[model samples]
Target: MIIVVDALNRHLFSDILAEMHALRARVFADRLGWEVTVKNGMEIDEFDALNPAHVICLDDDGDVVGCMRLLQTTGPHMLADVFYDILDGEPPLRSSRIWEATRFCVDTEKLKGRTTRNSISYVTSEVMIGAFEYARDAGVLDAVAVIDPVMNRVMQRSRNAPYDYLGTPKQMGKVKAMAALMDCSEERIAGIRDFAGINHDVFGSDDEVLSLFKENNGSAGNGSREITLESAYDFAPEPEAVRKPTRKDLREYCEAQVASAANDEEKVAALALKLELAEILRGDVQNRCDA
Candidate 1:
């Protein structure tokens, strides 16, 4: 099966929306026996239009089989809107730098065999990589996912421990649980860089990291087995080496980041330090730029 990842833009919006509705109807109503009604032959809500979303399309002998939706946490998102009850209304979602990963569905009929689990794993990994790439480009520092316990375990094992959990799994339904937070640190970035080294042609360019963030946004948070990375330093650095940012460039980036934060005192304070570091870097750059 070939998987095509597309950004949720005007060109592909209608198709993705339709695909989303069909997948939801099949998974929720048919498979899980949920009581949700399918209207206008679509399943949608307010959150669907908010934030940028990515859609994953599967080609099974030229048929669209599986799909998912991923949204970045920019404004009122899943943490505050949908999963607030599970979080006890005290989760640190308000000022946290996180992406909300949700809305994952697959075509069971097309993938009904011993390799089903592995196929899901492979697709999930692709989605995750897409989500990470999106977050990085948008300057999102972290991600929060609400997933089923079983699927969480599968995700955790697939990554072989590439993430850290910020909260205990909150059981919401029979086979599901709500959890949040994942690692997207510089260390994790390094690991990905290394992975792409030997398999450069397979993973595409370095910028492909942004796509992972976009594609995986939906499934990033849903029910899955939890996995954690054993060590953050497992991967080697790029052969070309990373160049340090000039102080001016650093300062500009930091200021832009600071300005983007919401009116949260704690968030402002935390970002202030980052801004200071950028300022110092800027000073260094000034010295060099002037020289």
Candidate 2:
């Protein structure tokens, strides 16, 4: 399934983001031969500082397999800041309703199969569907993506071909790169789903996503399955169907987390997460209180 992660909830999905960063470093830097900053095994750039919303596809095993970054075109983006040269003499496209789609990559090494319209790869189509739906829901009407010729072809095969080109394709790094405009409408999303034959919701609900993460406590580097939160806080994860957590349950969970914190930083982080959790569990709390 795909997870839509923004700035507010990014801390909650730390494990997934870490895996995506590592994957980006592998795809953009190691394989694609792009000039990107890779620090501590993460492909992070100035745009990351802007806190763009990430549409990430996690495999059935809850491992990140595909990911894309979305940023508003009204603000600073790659095409405006860095790749403007590729635009040639044409003015940079900027609009409030438009967003820039970049870092569009998937776990090619793992998937191995060449992602194409003919290839029924769940992760590939799922990521595209996730991205377009995310943009359309946020009132974004279109997106500009900087892609290589090969990816452009793949995009065409997927039945979501670019409607316009910013400029002629120019060589960048080891391949040719150009900007292509993509419409973010229901029609576009539907066409992609039609090609992939996926007709269901690709995203899980907010609570469902959080519960899944709580079940996965593996650290960033090591793959060892350690119950990070459960051990640190001393409680089983919130069962999906059992019952929603009450305000008291949330408070106790926060207390346990803060109490087990090794230092002030962790304590602060835990409390911040607690406040967020309090908001999420408010309805559950109110119901229990009324009972």
Candidate 3:
């Protein structure tokens, strides 16, 4: 399940946010050996103070297994400040329609298992879909991410490849960083959904996410172990049926996406999706009118 944490609802997710920071510490500092600030088992930096929206993926036990940060490009951001070298002396692209996505990571140890719902690939696709959808609904057109070569390929394999890139790859610590641009559109989301076999909504409701966090907040973390996430989630014999959204829900969501579209391409994609939903919902409208 994906829960987006931002300034508006930060208070309700303090514990989950803390665990997310700790997970970052483990991935960026310990595993990758990045020169980041880690204190008391949590990795934090000045960028975290900017009130960016955090797209977090939780395991069945409610542990944060994957996460990424999103910040508007018109304000202070990593590519503009910390990673200025990647710009190749060019000024950072600043616009209200563009957002900077950073700090993407997943818990390899916790999610270590066969390729299933909780595998690294699945979680990565979930987080990517969640972040793009959330931003698209809020009027964002594009996302610029500072990613390494491995992540670039990961995005391609996951069917969420970047449409363009800004500046050349520059060596940063143990990896080379390049700024990749991805559009926020229905097509992008659909491709990822197809690749990951995720057809239902990826965002978890606030109540469900909070309840899960509350349940597992007190559980002590045991050292790494070889375990399959399918067993952890108690995989059912058959996949559960996805609950389809109501017609009203579909209309409102499509309207919001259409309203938020930033360019001609995005607007076209949103309208196409709206048309597709309209066809799917035509019978419901007729049935209601007859009744």
Number of the top TM-score candidate: 3
lDDT of 1 by residue, 1-291 (tens): 223344434342333335555567778777877655555444454555443464454432323445555565435565555555666544335333666767666666665562532354444444455556556666677777777776666655554242655445565655556665666665554454343332222232323422433355342321131221111112223222323334444454455556655678846875876867968767988999999
Model 3 agreement with the true structure over 119-208: per-residue lDDT tens digits: 988999999999999999998989999999999999998889999999899999878999999999999999999999999988899988
> Model 1: which ten-residue window has the lowest total lDDT?
225-234
List candidate 1 stretches off by more than 4 Å.
1-8, 35-37, 60-62, 114-118, 160-162, 166-168, 185-291
Worst 10 residues of 2 by lDDT: 229-238
Q: How well does candidate 2 score on lDDT at residue 41? A: 63
Clashes of 3: 0
Per-prediction RMSD in angstroms?
A: 16.0, 17.2, 16.4
Candidate 3 residues lying further than 4 Å off, grouped into runs, are 219-291
In candidate 3, list every pair of residues with a backbone clash.
none
By lDDT, rank the candidates, best first: 3, 2, 1
lDDT of 3 at 14: 67
Best-first order by TM-score: 3, 2, 1
Clashes per prediction?
Answer: 43, 0, 0
Displacement of residue 17 (Cα, Å) in model 2 is 1.2
* Better candidate by lDDT, 1 or 3: 3
Cα deviation of 202 in candidate 2 (Å)? 0.4
Best by lDDT: 3
